[model samples]
Target: MSNTFSSPLAGRSTGDRLILGLAILLSLVMLLPVLWVIAMSLKDNAALMANPNSVFFPPYELTNYLNIFATSSVFRWIANSLIVSVSMTVGVLVLSSLAGYGFARLNFPGRDVLFVIVLFGLAVPEQAVVVARHQIFSLLKWHNTYQGLILPGLSSAFGVFLMTQFFRAIPKELDEAALLDNASRFRIFWKVLLPLTLPAQATLGIFTFLNAWNDYFWPLISATRKEMYTLTVGMASTQTNFAQSEGLGYLMAQAVFAGAPILIVYLFFQKYIVTAVSGAAQR
Candidate 1:
């Protein structure tokens, strides 16, 4: 008789195999809901309502997705979201980088105390300040404007903290060497230190963009007009009184559509995300 070969997992301990199996089981458990949603989106609303099990059957159609584009102001909302998210991300990066460099590299009066004040901002919940913020924006006539949405998010305490930590982790030798070349402080920061903090910037920028993109609460109050609504607010407006039972497929399609951009961004930046997480863990 021919010799039998061992499976690839044959050498792993029983505990290791059990752990691997559990990991796979958890992954499938998480994945099943997403798959179910996609399936529901592809099914006709009538079929889904008549028999929820119909998602497993074939004859899937894209009619529900088509209806979203045909009827809604989704493209306008998408544009609004992109503008706000991109503008906010750029602003946060610039301000955070400058503030971080100051805190990390320079000596100034009351610097530590000022930094502590910024840290305190992290503990203060946004809900605590929403009323005051809305009133101020109202006074400025900034309601229903892009600036209203973008400006508030730019004061990112977490972004400042992350950048400051990353900057401090860098050796001072680089700054000294740059100074030896007569480089200005701004030049050193722009040319030398900023590039070195790519991982932190990537992490910060991705999170900032995602948060701005999905910002419902602020935009809901700020963008009362249909034309000014962001994707999140716009999608919510599309729901009918009977959306749960009558327009289930359409609802799922809207979710998939609204989330598609975020998913694409994550796919492209996932390597950077992994690098940032792993680097943070090591430190």
Candidate 2:
């Protein structure tokens, strides 16, 4: 008689099963707050006030989400956010790619010193630089402009660092081979090395986009004009007086609405993100 396990998990030891079960339990526990928020978003504001626990009961509706769309400026805010985030992400990638290549492959006077200066930027808090940046932009009369919003975010030290590491990790033989084929430095970077760094680029781009999109404090101070407000700032501006008590559902709805686009983005690119993270871990 021959016996073999058909189910892969059938081979798992008791401890493995217990660990898997605990992982599932933890995942559900983590999801509880998100589930709560989604539930609150579906309940009527009045009903919620009367009975907060009604979210767990019946009579859910899409009124809160609809109300968000009903607001005239919501679409404008969304557009503004997209523009800033996309622009910043592109700028960061381009600048970082070039800077990374220079740092990784090229030799120049004071290269190490300049790289050290960039690393120093990683330690400097945004709050520390905000006053100076605001003052300079104010002097340039750049406030409430797209340039004001996008330009400041482009100097991404972390993006440069990540790209540099990715470039350095790539085998030098590829660069040498490209050079042997009469390829210039720029050509090698554009056609050879850049393609190999797709994982790192995806990782950097996703983080940069998310950071730019979710940024509120910077936009709040720089984009004082309502027309220039990003989604985060604009959403905050839309809140009516006493929103917590008077419009709990609507408030929760806004949270969901603001977060929904990023969630959708993550769902689409989760595989790439996972791949990037794994590659980084292995490196």
Candidate number of the best lDDT: 2
lDDT of 1 by residue, 1-283 (tens): 8659877578899999999999999999999988888988999999989998898998899999998888568799999999999999999999999999999999999999999999999999889999999999999999999999899999999999999998998999999999999999999999999998888888888999999998899999999999999999998998999999998988999888888888888888888889888988988
**TM-score for model 1?**
0.92
Per-residue error (Å), model 1, residue 280: 1.0
Evaluated at residue 165, the lDDT of candidate 2 is 93
Model 2 pairs in collision: none
What are the lDDT scores of the predictions, listed in order?
0.92, 0.93
Q: Scored by Cα lDDT, where does model 2 land?
A: 0.93
Best by TM-score: 2
| Root-mean-square deviation per candidate | 3.2, 2.3
Candidate 1 lDDT (Cα, 0 to 1): 0.92
Give the TM-score of each candidate: 0.92, 0.95
